[model samples]
Target: MPRIPGGATGVVLALLLAACTGGPGDAASDEEAAQSPADPAFVADNEAWRAERRAALLEPDGWASLIGLHWIELPAHYVGSGATNGIRLAKGPEKLGMLQQQGGRVWLVPDPGAALTVDDAPAKERIELLPDVSGTPTIVAFDEGKGQLSLVDRGGRKALRVKHAEAASLTGLGPLEYWPADPAWRVQARFVAHPQGKTIPIMDITSRQAPQPNPGAIEFEHGGAGYRLEALEGEDGGLFLVFADRTSGHGSYGAGRYLYTAAPDAEGRVLVDFNRAYNPPCVFTDFATCPLPPPENRLDLAVTAGEKKYRRP
Candidate 1:
């Protein structure tokens, strides 16, 4: 067999199964095509959206510029020695500033007459300070212990608090990689309802204690074998699945990829399209805490669909 670029052994299995089953015009192909939204129009739209998002994430002026992450527990006063202090402002290098903590508030004194901003907003209450490297001075204040950070945008919104950090996503170069868009892997599985919703205990990478939301189980048949998948509820209210099959560690992400099925239809039927399975956030950055697949979701059969393991950068 000619080797396919970026192809793995699992993909070969899926192709063999597809070849043995039927031709391109088979009913199964029709069903798989209907299930997959990879029709030219939808694929074009999806590609456009993904490219836009990727550009936003990778842009230098965007959140990817966040390079500092410090956790403070106690109230302490410190002076910013531009070189010593971890905080780096783009305005200049090695500029000294005053950082005072009083009543759970942090106040920063940038040079006198200089405009100060948080995240990207101009400082509301400006403080006068002595000149260091820059003659102009300004003051920026922040609530203590809040997840907010002060951004000094000289051009627009000089100072504002941004929730996401720039370096966090910038360093996340391990974007999800998927198998080729093959229709054979699109299997129509039946949803077997567990009247009493099933609960799957997930051990998160953070080692945090929490019970993952396993709504129920799904039963499907392939290659004369029976397989079952337990469903999990995601924060977005969409259904997520984390399952490991015989191909784990060999041909797929050892931790498993995530699959989302749309909310059940009026008749309570949901499509489990493996083609959309993707890598979890943990694949990209170590800072992310991802959930592992529960024992029940693990299968004995090889699932040759969705995304393959991400090669960390």
Candidate 2:
């Protein structure tokens, strides 16, 4: 199969999805053509979105930049790059600081002359480090601001997430492959609201389970079959869907793919755009604890749209 390399322009769209070919008069191809919006504006918008997505993944602190994730097991431990430290970092000063967890709070005491910054400001003394759960996690930047260390709390377990500007995963990242953008994959679905205050147990790649807010389910029809995806609360009150189709491990990411939908309209309608589906952070780094798709979200259908599997450079 021919893969579209990263940084390619929109002109290459005609050459996409070479593995899934069909004759010009094929029934499926005709149906997709009929459903596809020919508006130049739509094409331009999708192209722009793809450009933004590529730029985000290539950012210095993006998902591909992840280097390590060190769990804080002991109450207090030395954190640095030296082998003698209790929590050795992949990249940083030999004696970066001391991480201590007291009660329910975590604190970082920088080493003298280590030249660390807390949220971009100089840090010379012990500082309380906040986790992502607080909606504003404290960032401890070192190595001339190229290395970022942040505290993340997952299912009550806290750990240090590290990222570097020059991580091999980022510098050597391969292109993002995708199925051809077919409008037939964009279906308008119905949102069935779940009982208020309901939550669902979500398991991550690390095997830790946590109950996340479950607002509702998006019910849609494709290829004459009905399907449903449990929707989690997403950014700005949107709906986040993590799902696996028959393509998993065949042509797409083995674990699953992520799709985001705008908030349902007053009439309970949602535009489920499968073309925007993307891979999770786990695809770019092994250190990420990405969520697994719940059984209810796994579909037997072969969704031939959205992102394909990622290949390392």
Candidate 3:
């Protein structure tokens, strides 16, 4: 597929699953719409949900805030906004701090009175940092909460990801478009559990290979054709589906889209609501590292339910 290189926060992902109801549009009249209860909240709720999604994506530390992704190569590198620093930050203090890697452990040593915070608390000296792969990551907040620094482990390589609230992409975001909601696209599927310890090779936009846990697969039928999508377990134990369809490069985001579904019931059945599918962070920012859909997850059918393409303005 084409490369469209993309943070997706928890709240934004939650809204994608909960607020998108794949049914009809608004009612004939105001009274009729609000009075008749055929999934009456569909239209109104979706509008409000889209607004929140946009706001969240533009948050101080959202994907739009991303400014740089510098790989940590040396044992210790000076981090600052000035060009003189080894790892120059796009926007931050002139000489913020230094990152030193000890015997497999990394520490952040702040410059004298550089004004950095560890986990929102003042960092007068040095502090250990955890990579994003770890469950808990140490956020080096600086520039008074507008700038954030963190370590990200990509394919066994460590890098410092930088974010600033005043990124140009945040202000240049164009409008988001979507196809009219269709209940028919919100089909059902059955979850088939994979053997224990099953995993799938996930490829990121940067062409890095990362093995992701594959708990199971979602089996469903559309257009009289059977399909299966590899399922990855999310933080809440729900099924996270990153997939591509015929619309991928035609009308939708060239990279693909994402969908979240509830865990399967005892019968191993889950609802695959395509209407709730959304574009990945790559749709908005090139810095985002979104995973590509595996071979099994690429469908020949055109999924015209969720979001449409976002042309940068």
Candidate 4:
């Protein structure tokens, strides 16, 4: 399995080759030069973007740091590293506390002797723990702020998402792999608006389905073939696309990849950059609840750009 989501991997030889000689020599260099735009600014911008992407992944609380995911099925659970606890944590004090789900809210009663924090403040009593659905999940920090636990709601099911700075996945993460910086993968597409309030049922990795906003679709021609991707709402009015192509499981993430297109212009034109396509969070960690591509978004074309599959350390 891949080690990181929003990421991909290269064979061991290719990774070592990339680390030592910049890349696989002549053929790789030729491919990059042929697909790159003549404008130096394009390459510079892509480089800047890649640097920022790596920075995000390296953050202490980034996706790579994820270590555990525990479901909350009962009304109450004694969470701790102790074997006797109902919800045994992967890491923490032997007796962390009691988690009680009452009505629609969740509360945590910390162990008096356990050093913990609720939203960074010292925890000494029971406190309301907000779920992610509230737009601000309460962060329960332990291990001297190196470990964090947060409540997440997925399709009305609740789970504890755990992360630790010293996780093997983070410290042992390998270098990112890619097909190369290709300008040709950046194509201009037309956005076709959907009916007002249209929604699509999207299934996540957990097999739970939920209706998500379907604001529009992006239609583009790649390699002389027509393709359409149902667009989901994105940050700042942009478009979020989850799709699978011929490259899936061959040279990319098997589940699929993700892409973001800026809001369409007045003329309904937008640029879809396949080079910026990325793997989902599930690619890196099993704890992630990433959405799979809907049937309508699967394409037959081989998109030989963007991220390759991720190799774990």
lDDT of each: 0.49, 0.81, 0.75, 0.78
Q: How many pairs in model 2 have backbone atoms within 3 A of each other, for residues 3 or more apart or on separate chains, i.e. clashes?
A: 0
**Local error of candidate 1 at residue 139 (angstroms):** 20
Question: How do all models score by TM-score?
Answer: 0.54, 0.88, 0.85, 0.87
How high a TM-score does candidate 3 get? 0.85
Model 3 CA deviation exceeding 4 Å by range: 1-40
TM-score of 4: 0.87
Cα lDDT of model 3 overall? 0.75
Top candidate on lDDT is 2
Better of 1 and 4 by lDDT: 4
Alpha carbon lDDT at 219, candidate 2: 96
Model 1: per-residue Cα lDDT over 1-313, one tens digit each: 0000113434533432332333323422333333333567645654554566456646643444343323323343222325555443323324334444445344555544333455456554533322211333232322221223442322111222222333444656446554445454556676656556566676544333356556676777766778888887754444677766654555566666677777665555666767666666555544333565666766766665666766756
Q: Give the top-scoring candidate (TM-score).
A: 2
- Name the better of 2 and 4 by lDDT: 2
What is the per-residue lDDT of model 4 for residues 74-168, given as tens digits with 9 covering 90 to 100? Answer: 99999888999998877778998999997777888999878999766899989788888788789999888988888888777888888888887
Model 1 error, position 136 (Å): 36
Candidate 2 residue-wise lDDT, 1-313, digit = tens: 0001123322222222222233323423433444454367766777787888888989999988999999999999999999999999999899999999988799999999679998678999998999988989899999999999998899789999999999999988888887767777889999999999998887777666789899999999997889999989987778999887767666777677899989999999999998899888888887887776777877867777788889877
What stretches of model 4 exceed 4 Å from their correct place? 1-39
lDDT (tens digit, per residue) of candidate 3 on 1-313: 1113114443333323223222222111211222223254676666776787788878988887888888888999998988889999888899998889867678889998679988678998778889888869889998899989998888778888888898887877788887665555667899899998999988766667678889999899975888888988764567999887666655676566888888888898888777678888777776667787776776766676678878877
* Cα RMSD, model 4: 7.0
Give the residue spans of candidate 2 off by over 4 A. Answer: 1-40
